[model samples]
Target chain A: MDTQQAAGTSVLPADPGALTPAEARAAFRSGLAVPTAGWSRGFAQANLIIVPRDLAFDVLLFAQRNPKPCPVLGVLDAGETSGPLLAGGDIRTDVPRYTVYRDGQKVDEPTDIRQYWRDDLVTFIVGCSFTFESALREGGISIAHIDQNVNVPMYRTEVRCEPAGSMAGPLVVSMRPVPASQVADAVRITSRYPAVHGAPVHVGNPHELGIADLARPDFGDPVDMPEGHVPVFWACGVTPQAAVMESRPALAIGHAPGHMLITDARDSQYLVP
Target chain B: MDTQQAAGTSVLPADPGALTPAEARAAFRSGLAVPTAGWSRGFAQANLIIVPRDLAFDVLLFAQRNPKPCPVLGVLDAGETSGPLLAGGDIRTDVPRYTVYRDGQKVDEPTDIRQYWRDDLVTFIVGCSFTFESALREGGISIAHIDQNVNVPMYRTEVRCEPAGSMAGPLVVSMRPVPASQVADAVRITSRYPAVHGAPVHVGNPHELGIADLARPDFGDPVDMPEGHVPVFWACGVTPQAAVMESRPALAIGHAPGHMLITDARDSQYLVP
Candidate 1:
């Protein structure tokens, strides 16, 4: 089917249906509301951040400084509703949901942000660890969150992000339980894709990255650690979103947790090695 | 000895007699004449590009797109001569020699470029392959050009660089004859230094990269290819200089070939793994 006609159809009634990235994006644009975790398999998903033009340079610098946590996939032109470079998907309504922040407070969860879109907004799409997680799973590493059907445990660490201009915050991380024998393989696999969160930021000791407890997390549900599985921490894409909150912009927007912007771009485009 | 005093005492009659990066840069600023390669032993050497304010963004975008050949070390603001971010080195005179180009033509080679400095000029310091070359040597890979006492063989390739505005040209690659046994080791060693042209662009056959005769190079002298030694090519720093020449800006400035800018930044800063 042609892309436009395919897009005209609403989202699949259930999560089990097969949906291409383009179709999933279309469903999102049509307001077929759902989180994008399992919407488009084998396709790359991105964390979205929308900020005013004045703060674009600072935010971009921050990403550049902390690449592990914020691997920028594409930077859209100011006020551009479509990501022409990355996926040719409309940014306005292509994401199933968005959280609007006004002066550091979450004021609204909008299904479609076309009503709040402005001419001066710049969109930054950052690579999420979902791409690397797929690689790990393919390599036979089991992910506890996927097995338990829970969001990956995320934490705000004592490790401060390299501050850029007015945007500064603690480094945020996501933890995954990995078997000890497969940890080296996991590093080798993820290291090939630096544009995605790359390799694990911390492997054995969680406290080295300033996390005091694996049982307690700043965000997401903590899953039970299986026998012989060690907690591996990676720089999370949610870092920039947290920074935006602490930095307190007059206006900011981001994808709600577990809901990502599905892009037409493939996961392989991000692989370096 | 103090760095300034060391600079004054080390001014030899021939070759300026090997000074540290700081001493060498200070001497270069004070009219000392010499190539910078041998002086800064373990520090990173950079290719310098000075262009007008109008072309800065495009040139930067071009570098971003073509990172293998043109790894950007630091970019100075318009009218600025020193790069405070990279090494706090003076752009106008820290380099051993400067080549001035006007309307795509080489006008003069000067020890210092203060006379050519303009308020609208923006300076770009790009990473050079010397750091990786040093790493290869440390890993016991013998470089033929250093042994033959000639410039590394460089050729203009059929590969087209991603265009950014008016900046676009064929990529230039430097060739090294490596023994077959050391090819894997060479790749591994050089891959660790992404900031310094990274790994080999093309290995083994020169024909693969469209180079017809290995005996004759478009730039630099050809070296002896020992038996069982395969030709390895790397993305050259000259690619951006060639792009600038093609763009034909009214004024362009660069380092004379083999005459690099010695920065206080250590080569260790560029090693990724």
Candidate 2:
């Protein structure tokens, strides 16, 4: 089996870590639609949130007020795609697929959002948990979902996010099972990547976060937990989507679950120290 | 001498560190106008900025793009004075003094901005270097300006700030001298407080940063540096004022040089680790 198969990645470049950000973007723009989990390897992949200019401040405030769940990587001006950090990257056609929402309901999924582009649409690229997962793997920690080639399970928690403006929602978290022996190591490695959902919000106590069952998740698929493992949860970037849906904005667009926009920022750049 | 007198602090409450944020702010509103140097000792004091709603985005973007110099503590909504972090603290009269800028000129310095308050005004409370100064003193690090009972010497460096929209100018930096033996410890301690200008940007190399003379400063008073001391530069919060002045916005307001807004956030809350 190739390295992709060995790592249980869906479809990644031959040299995943070696694939530069430009190559990853080119892959997505060329209609190579797939989950961005293993593709850019060492670079951060971002969640996309496009909203009308009228609601832009509320959304930005949501991210600022709830940084743990929605650590914003960059905010592009209205009618603008490329930001100072994500220079030369297109927001409309990036990330392989886009899901448009209206009034808290999913309306349509499109391959590219060129047709929906509006002058008032503002794009916010938020940091994703993938950066921390990579750090976990680097430290010899085995991620259960990655091992099984399944999507990581996510749950809406009892923890309400610190609200901003008219936006407020429960914190959504992605769960991973780690051997009790390696819990401290997991915390240490993930704490180093704060920009990308750094550190676990809860360790072993899913009930405290309002998580009822590991087998049932609000988003993504569940994974089989091996013995001697405890569930660890990190703030998920999918939060802004939930927050937007709650407020029911007339126009909202985001990357389909798993599909993400690849950025040029190195994952190591987000490391705390 | 009392502890405040030995610290060369201007008029402070009998138990300076023991005074609460509310008491300190009430003192200001009651016309107890003095430098907020030693008052409310453990609480983080703030540098205040106010601009019209039209220019709020540009100003906020400046702080977001240049966090080192303008680390935002909290941003209040337009026409709103209280923030989540600065709760119960009035933005208008709580600051001992306010400076009004019109088309880049200082038109008035008011004790309270109640008359100048406009519905379109947005308040931005930025992290001041005073928090880090306290941290330094806690670590047995001597601050020359505080010891001399004078304002910290600030210089306009040749280093260009990261421009955000219409906001752009040379970076304003505050200079503090450290003993050669304590420079590393100083950096280690200060780096813990990223919200307050973090660690020194440049150490021991004023010419490299385009600073000509240590004794001659663009703002504030110069202090004596003893032998074997090296100049360390930290990004100063006054950078926004410099940027605003250069851009010459139609209307702008900020705290007077020595006067600052005391907030409810504890200085220890900003400690990263």
User: Pick by TM-score: which candidate is best?
Assistant: 2
**Model 2, B228: alpha-carbon shift in Å?**
1.7
Worst 10 residues of 1 chain A by lDDT: A8-17
* RMSD to truth, every model: 4.8, 4.4
Q: Given candidate 1, what's the lDDT at residue A139?
A: 95
> For candidate 1, lDDT tens digit of each residue in A1-273?
345435555534455226787767777777766555555667788888899977775676677668899987777767878854436678988887898998878898887898889999988898888777777888999878777877678899889998866789888898888889998988898888788799889998888888888898987778898899888888888898889989999999998766788877777888775
Clashing pairs in 2: none
**Per-residue lDDT for B101-145 in model 1, tens only?**
888788888988989999988788888887777778889999898
- Model 1 per-residue lDDT at B130: 76
Task: Please state the error at residue B40 of candidate 2 in Å.
Answer: 2.2
What lDDT tens digits, residue by residue, belong to model 2 across residues A1-273? 244433434355566557777766766665666666666788888888999877877787788678788888887888997765556767876577788999979898886788889988988888988887788988999888767877778898989897777788889998989999999999999987878888888999999888888899887789998899989999998898888888898989998766788898888899877
Interface RMSD of 2: 1.8
Q: Largest DockQ belongs to which candidate?
A: 2
> What are the per-model numbers of colliding residue pairs?
0, 0
Error of 1 at B204 (Å): 6.4
